[model samples]
Target: MSAAATDHEHALVYPDEPIYSRITAGKLAMWLFLLSDGFSFSGLLLSYGILRGSSQVWGCTTEAIAKTFGCIEEPALGINFTALLTFLLICSSVTMVLSHASMVEGDRKGALKWLGLTVAGGALFLVGQCWEYWGLFGLFGPHHGLIHEGLKFGATHYATTFYCVTGFHGLHVLTGVLYLSAVWIGTAMGKTDANTLEVAGLFWHFVDLVWILVFTFIYLIPN
Candidate 1:
């Protein structure tokens, strides 16, 4: 065979690496994890929607005496408070991206600064969530004046789905915060690379994205 023909055959048999070869294995693994996690979150939120739709009433109103009059025949999940939590989470995503950017720029201090802010944002979000859950379930002490008595867990499908969905998301936020913290510590100790930071950022961003969906479907939607 001619040299040109042999070379052509070799080229065809040994193609270049796939496009995804540009992505580090760690990054690729993170994407795969996020994709599967996304499906789980989607299933939970879809189930919430179905349950809410089937229910005749899905909300409650409080009387002046701090008692729940009963389910309000509509969907309401404390939009104002949850909206604030959503905002915090979105802002954390911004910080996460900034942290990655700083790492790429070889500014370890800047990266640490942004990562610290991101962790704080996640921690704040968890605090707000715990407060919300406490109010709903009266877990720690006497029921707060702001929450109605009828809003305990297992009271209705609304309560069940609300806690299950938001509680799941809250767990993710907590995990992300702890994960970011570990990354930050590793970076500080010079044990972590930019790729590791980027991978952590991917998880943080996914957590934020899922919260936006949860906030919209669970908190903002009306029956």
Candidate 2:
């Protein structure tokens, strides 16, 4: 590169070089924010761990156990149902990558198509989450939802921690959905570049990953 091409962002910085690193300022800022957010999740999970470990009867797995703990008969988590939600998130990550690839390839319509699907996936996942919590009129199957099945929040350490961790992650998904929707609108208007979608992908993937961990610890772990 010639000195004529040099344009320093700061007097102390090398000409024609990034001030901080290879990533653009937007991406770097997002990474830093996610790091702090990660710490918050870690704290919540740690508290849950401490409580679960110290309690002799964290969750009532059987009638005899519930009787011993004097807990109302709470339904065991429907692992099959929650597993489907996890799969939905993982698939959305794939669509997000496709959308980025399509944008870079100059396929405007293709990018919008995949990106639209990605948004739909996120929306569907949120609906599924609501169904898990409240049953949503009991439309799908016999299950009437967790809360109605006796997993009310604040009733026990098990119930409270379950809602806190999963509910927090649910909020992230909701935010991701809205963020993607705005990006979709901007993309349609030619106001956004591939980098914008990539940043959105980072947040979406982060939420998906956190959900995986939350699933393992909160649902997969045995009482």
Candidate 3:
């Protein structure tokens, strides 16, 4: 047989088209997982809304609330600081898109660089959350942390919902960081491909988008 014919015969075969709705199995699976995950967040946020809306006061900012609840007064959510974290996630989302674009363009180095930035952004956001919850290393600025000041989980509806929602989202950020790190390493070793990176990007993008909502409902909303 000719060399071309022999090589063609041995070439691996792939599905001629996507498994469903012009989407690959991997992408479809990720979408389904995201949908279920979305419901969890929705339930949490819905409960938060109902509680906050029905309550006479959301935060223990006033003296009467502090006295009535028998709980130490907790400050309102800090929009300024959380806003910074939001911006970081937004920037990370951009880097994630660039990473996927680079991979699609067959530029492995560019992909790696952008993906690294995306991971860093996620890592930093987690650290920021830590700083928000508890001062870093319990060193300087410890009192500013929510835990140190107040806002303890199970303390109040405001505090509980804040922790449950933001904490849940923070866990997602942490997961995304680790997930992207694995993909980053795999890509560096030449095992991962654009499709793989795209799936990771979908997850990272979902995380960032969810944070926007969390920040809005949990922080920006007037208490």
Give the winner by TM-score.
2
lDDT of 1 by residue, 43-74 (tens): 99889888888865556533421244444332
Q: Which stretches of candidate 2 lie above 4 Å from their native place?
A: 1-20
Candidate 1 lDDT (Cα, 0 to 1): 0.80
Clashes of each: 0, 0, 0
The TM-scores, one per candidate, come to 0.81, 0.90, 0.88
Candidate 2 has what TM-score? 0.90
lDDT of 2 at 31: 88
lDDT against true structure, model 2 = 0.89
Candidate 3 clash pair list: none
* RMSD value for candidate 3: 3.3
Candidate 3 C-alpha lDDT tens digits along 10-112: 5535455744534667887999999999999999999999999998778997678889877678876788888999999999999999999999999999999
Give one digit per residue, the lDDT tens place, for model 2 in 1-223.
5554554332233234456655766777788989999999999999999999998887775799878878677778878889999999999999999999999998978888989999999999999999999898789887688899889899889999999999999999999999999999999999888778888889999999899999999989887
What C-alpha lDDT do the candidate models reach, one value each? 0.80, 0.89, 0.89
Of 2 and 3, the candidate ahead on TM-score is 2
Q: How many angstroms is residue 113 displaced in model 1 relative to the true structure, after the best TM-score fit?
A: 0.4
